[model samples]
Target: MRLRNHEGTPVDPVPFLVVVGLTFMFVLSFGPLYGQALGAGLELSVGVSFALFLAVAFGSYYWQVWTARPETVGVVPASVRAVRLFYLMLVLAVLMIGLAIPLML
Candidate 1:
């Protein structure tokens, strides 16, 4: 029921989400578009929000990377696939929380 890459690899959700988040933030960082997107808000406010989002996305993405290590998820003596998944999850979580700080400022 899912799609797999030509190399027989499934799509990595964590990275996929991170990329999307980054793209969104990048677009928002533009001055004219930023103002238009969030009308009536100060420029600094938009910048801060974008910064926070960038932080969260970065943090979580890295967290998942650590957790997804093959050695870390060797609990069931499985292959590297499971390890990758674990790290992916961890990365996503960190990214989500890390993005909040700059936004709050």
Candidate 2:
């Protein structure tokens, strides 16, 4: 499957994956805690990892658009803005839930 940028442009997966891959690698390198959790018992860790990866990817896409499309600022339709805000909140909630699950476990 291919990844789309915030503006629905088909982003080059090579560059996007490079950014996300390095981020995931950096995360796993922090300590053995994640590894132990994954190996020993906590299956939620996998979900958390995937959720984080998605969050980072979307965030990066938005950041790219924000920087590259300065002229499009203030031209967004209200409905589109609302939809974006809803998705942003939903993703944030998912991120929080993912983190909370690890702590709860």
Index of the highest-TM-score prediction: 2
Give the clashing residue pairs of candidate 2, or none.
none
TM-score of 2: 0.38
Model 2: runs farther than 4 Å from truth? 1-15, 28-32, 35-40, 65-105
Span of ten consecutive residues with least summed lDDT in model 2? 26-35
Kindly list the per-residue Cα lDDT of model 1 for residues 2-57, writing each as its tens digit: 32344444434555475656656553544334454456467666676677667766
Residue 78's lDDT within candidate 1 is: 60
Clash number for each model: 14, 0
TM-scores for every predicted model: 0.33, 0.38
Error of 2 at 18 (Å): 2.4
Candidate 1 — what's its lDDT?
Answer: 0.55
* Candidate 1 error regions (>4 Å): 1-41, 70-105
